[model samples]
Target chain A: MLEAFVFATILFGFFGIILKKNLMMKIIAMDVMSTGVIAYYVLVASRGGFFTPIFSGETVAYADPVPQAVILTAIVIGFSIQALMLVGVMKLSRDNPTLETSEIEKNNTP
Target chain B: MNQITIVWIALPLFLGFSGYLLPKLDRYFVLGMALLSIAYGLQRYVAADTLTLELIDSFGVTLVVDSLSSLFILANAIVTAAVVIYSWQTGKSAFFYTQAIILHGSVNAAFICADFMSLYVALEVIGIAAFLLIAYPRSDRSIWVGLRYLFVSNTAMLFYLIGAVLVYQANHSFAYAGLSQAPMDAIVLIFLGLLTKSGVFVSGMWLPLTHSEAETPVSALLSGVVVKASIFPLARLALMTDDLGLILAVFSIGSAFLGVSYAIFETDSKRMLALSTISQIGFVLAVPAASGFYALTHGLAKAALFLIAGNLPSRNLRELRQTPIALPLWILLVLASLSVAGFPLLAGFGAKTLTLAGMAPWQEAVMNVATVGTAIVFAKFIFLPFSAQPEAKEGKKYTVGFWIAVLILVGGLVAANGIYMDAYTVDSLLKALIKIGIGWLIYFLIVQRFILKLPRGMEQFDQLIGVMSLMLVLLFGMMLT
Candidate 1:
């Protein structure tokens, strides 16, 4: 059932990228797509059990910790990439004073 | 925990940051260190056995250097060495050197990684470093192109990450060793992601634009090896998915034709070379066994071409007669162009002959057209130095680096004679020579006459993105049903 949501979110993101003329929105769509994937990973890792992953003396079944840890690193990487994209968009907007990707090149002030 | 493995991965990155930190001493220090590192690396050849350096056991962040990767590592070393030497004069900024080093380390990491998580991280590293390098000049068009590359590639990488998730859900491991029974959707998604990075048709439309807009040496590296870093993984993926072979062959053939056709239409030298990269990559992907060898030879030759393009006084195809280049540079240009066209006695010819032995006749014919198209495009350069006006400034270091690259493209055949010699028979040599002859004839007769020309509409970003969406749907349908 959750997998369907992942698909829907990915579809939504693709629509934004394909339809949106503003570069910032396209970047947002990229972020949304990554968010969908990250959600799916966390959901899959927790399927076996719901207990805390931290180990204790008692034997309690626990969820897979790998995906959570992996997601953390992935999140950081994604954040940095987003930052870079935003920086690029900022520079682009400053140069053109417009948000439209197609118009930016054509209406260059310089 | 091989000590050499650590050195191979870490030294470039270490030097990269140090160069940034110590700008006054950066030039000589980094160059001397690079030379020293190359001297040390040449002493012993790394064998194929897997060596895993585990960073985190649970998430599978490990680095693996196997026989496959060792060869790529060797190629990367040679290319990086050449780039360092050539960029010394052209690359004015210390930050450029720093990015080059980090790019080297990131590419190495991507090549050597053992698990999906490490692969993802390494790929991101390569992406970020490449973005900086592409934007190094801070020119308006370059920044915009780099941004497009960033957005497109990052979005594509999500497909790969999602694929990894599905693979992990199916089997609780991310290692390549356990991918045999992975879900088909997961495989398709991963392949789609990689195809974007690998510069295959439809998906790789941004490559030519981005590569052509960068600084000349950066463009050389992009066309030469950065694209191949993504291909290394796809090569491994091919081994696991039997269904992918047919699809890959078809796409490779398509890309080969598209790339060469576009190259024929392109009048800008750098853009033409960029288009040819897609074509050459197509050739390598079509032949699996000799893909690595093909990539190495292509990298050497393509880098030499880009560097030569950098040194040219004028780059327009119409200005070929007026552009006065040195005799040695002219000779080097011909050698590089001929090598790319698969002329006999060159390394590309050796790779082509070996790979063609296993291809179907129709596929072989397709590759022949690709070769002809390459020859057609580069034939423009044959008359560049017709009336030498004055030699362009050529630095001694840059010239030496260019010659070394050409030497590798020629000498690599002798070095790997045992593996490739059986395929280099008299019949194969004659066939290669005949192909070149035909290519030249077609160029002089048909292309020069302007009897055939392809529209340049696909070169635009807006149109390419539309095609990319359509390709995704078509590829998904093909893979699933």
Candidate 2:
């Protein structure tokens, strides 16, 4: 079920970037994509395993933990991209007082 | 030294942070400090070892250096030095952002890294830093360009992360060394998605849009070194498969030819520099595809070309002989341009000579054509300086440094002959001389003349061709594989 959500989020993010006219929506789409990929990573590895990775003390199915560790790095990457997008958005607004990609194109051409 | 690892992460971090800490330090100082840091880092990393990096592991990252890392470290440091100097030339008085400096340093930290997770962090930091540098001059257009770069690059990064995740799922480990232990072919194929992050155009669309639009010096870094940093990992992956190198070979020629073609037609100097970069990268890619040594040779030569390409002034070639570039600058420009053309006794010539000798089966003549195609394009550039008033900033403040840098680059190539020469028995001075002669012939006959649209058959790089590459890739990618 969570895999389904992750796939759906990827679509939402993909379309958000390709189809959205507003820069804000595009940034949000990027965020969605990042979240979806991370979700998929966790779901794929951590899913249903009867035997826990916990071999030390208990027979706990601790599940794979490497994906979780890797995800922390991905999360940081996502944040850096977000901060950059915001900076881009702020700069865009300062230049044209608008956040519309369409408007910027028109401004440049006209 | 093992201690050098933190300096890679810290120097830019320090310069970047200090800019914030001491807001009034002239931007030149920040830039100078960054240049000094990269030079020192490069000097030390010339012999840097691949060791267990504990400090990076706190963030679940492991920084290490091997031949691949050192090559990237050397290339990045060289370009960073050039970019910092150029940055100072233009914006020494303006309030340059500290973020840009941090971004540059952190990205270098990423390049020196050994693990996927840590590499991702560095990629993201570089992405943000790149975005801000592009948009810092502050116009609506700059912002949109920054967004476009951010969106495309980060999306590719996520794709790479997913590819990494899939590999991890199969292998249960995250370091590159560990990822190699996985046996799944499907997951290995997914690794191309990581190459996409490096920007190749089929799977990579960010190449044309992002790097082409960044500020001049920033564009130099983004094109000259950033794309290359990602390439080392891809090369590492290719080392795993015997056929993978051969498959990527076809794409390399196409990339080089197309990049040069676009550069020929391009008007803006920065955009032209960017196209030249893409073209040169085609050669860089071709090296690993042909042989690993080609990649190393291409890296050092191309990095030098791109770093200084920005500083050399240009005008259209048609009017060039009628007017003259500054004699000294013009001569320097010729030497640089010839180096790109693979003229004998220079860095590029040596690599081209080796590569020509290495081409398999019947592609030798075609490769020769491509070499001249590069010459044809550079002829356009070399003449540009003389066409109109040379725009090279007057009084050449760092003229000594420029000459020193050029000499070091030239000297490195001459020294490499002893190291790389013995591998290919057929490669010789005679072949090198022929390549130079052909390169010069093209410069004299066609490129130096009035713009006459040639019949499609005499085609040089990207022109008369690209409308066909999509179809070609469909067949080429499958056929080569």
Candidate 3:
């Protein structure tokens, strides 16, 4: 049930991305969606009354270790892409001081 | 270490580092790495054996040098090499240079990986590479489009992860060999997320805008070369689930029709090429949906077509409206386009034949519709080079080596068909002509009527493509239920 919450928040934020005209809002929405997804993985990783993972020598009540591992890689890749997007945003700001999300080189805007 | 396993992952890492260190050396390093891998991959491809090696603990990923992976891996290697030749002087930053090599490597990695978890990681690598490169042009729209892809792909990746956890629960194993029949619901959910990544449909709305807004060569790589990487998982899912055959058959056919509708209306030759790509991908997916040979054959031809389109548009074709031979290169590209349209002897013919052969009688209609769809879209594409007159007075002579490479590829494909299939008599040629005739008739009736000359007209087409995709998504939702 809580998984639905995280997904809803993510989709709501994406609507901000699609609806809002601000670039920062879009980036924030992107971050929001990423966090929602990460949370979903963590939650899903923990199933049943006691989520136990079998490990060598010592067994621990670990959530699905697979989601954790996968989410870790997703986080790293996400950070790099976020960095790339920020670089692009910085370039756009430099080229055109006002960064409207939908602007595509319209001369009349300025 | 088996040569296939080691070479697939390590060579790119080695090439990437060297390419990163030396700006002048990156393209060649990437080109060399792809060529080397193709040579190594071909051996396993011919052996028809599943090759493997562990890079770590029992937890380590296995490289499955089977027919499926080898076909995609070798095709990518060929595409990347041709890109190096075509982009001989593209002095983009060292960042993109290294990224391109890693991208190709990541793609080859995904194709060869045997374990579900390894395939997932490799897919993540490819997805990140896609995100970075899509906006690497550093333009305003490129950034926006890249973000669109970022949001959609990451979210899809989450669904894929959840799907993975479920699969683990159901099957109790991750090896391709261990992929016993997963529950239909689990398989369907996993593919739902993955379809977005692969740009098939439902999740494929990002295809045209992102691929089109990026720089030409990168666009080519994204549409032509990069899309194949994601097919690995989708194909695996299809192999796992019983219902996936029908799912693949239906959705790919929808993608084929939808992709063409957009392409026929697009004005920018580059973006039109991009739309044509989605439809071409539909063909590739359809082949594998039915059988293996189609997947292998279509992957190779489409990769070549994408790479060729990436280079040909370095100059907007608007200048050659009248001079028929203004760009003689178009003649060969037309041949490439012909091959993509499933004209007989070209590579697509063999693949399409197998795809159609595998289908039951009922499914042939779907295949035919896709063919006419491909024809309708590419008609816009084939006529584009000739639409502009010979007004390009720059008189820049194309490099001798460039034409040599193109001619060699064209000749090699026809000859390789004979070698690969062992008998390419006049029968193939006649078949190809018939296919071309069907495509040509569709163009005359439907596509030619709505012609747009400048990029502005394409904006309307993009919007229309957007609307059409949304409608299909709604329809697909009902169907999937």
Each model's DockQ? 0.55, 0.43, 0.33
| TM-score versus the correct structure, for each prediction | 0.91, 0.79, 0.84
Fraction of native Cα contacts reproduced by each candidate: 0.60, 0.64, 0.24
True contacts kept of 2: 0.64
Higher-scoring candidate on TM-score, 2 or 3:
3
Q: In candidate 1, which residue pairs get closer than 3 Å at backbone N, Cα or C atoms, i.e. clash?
A: B48-B67
The number of residue pairs in model 2 that clash at the backbone is 6
Which of the predicted structures, 1 or 3, would earn the higher DockQ when compared with the native? 1
B57-143: candidate 1 lDDT, tens digit per residue: 464556766656655655566666677667655536888878777887788777777677778888888888899999887777778
| Candidate 1 segments exceeding 4 Å error | A57-61, A107-110, B25-62, B387-419, B451-453
* Candidate 3 residue-wise lDDT, A28-109, digit = tens: 7767767876787677667742455666686656666766776687788778767766776786686656666446335211
- Report the poorest 10 consecutive residues by lDDT, candidate 2 chain A: A101-110
| DockQ score for candidate 1 | 0.55
lDDT of each: 0.74, 0.59, 0.64
lDDT of 1 by residue, A59-108 (tens): 77788888888889999999999998898888887777768887864542
Could you give candidate 2's per-residue lDDT for residues B303-325 as a string of tens digits?
45554554444333343444455
State which candidate has the highest DockQ: 1
Q: Assign candidate 3 its CAPRI class.
A: acceptable
Estimate, for each residue in B1-481, the C-alpha lDDT of model 3 and write its tens digit: 3754675577886788787678888877887887886786677667777676655643435666676666666667766676566667656677787888888888888877777677777777777777778777665567656756665666566556555655655554555544345444445446666677777753565677777777655765676567777776667656655455667777777777777777667655566676777776676677564333444445445545554555553434444333444456666777777666777667667666666666668777766766766766666547754533555546455555455545645664564454245324476556556766787897777656656643443232123223333533553574467
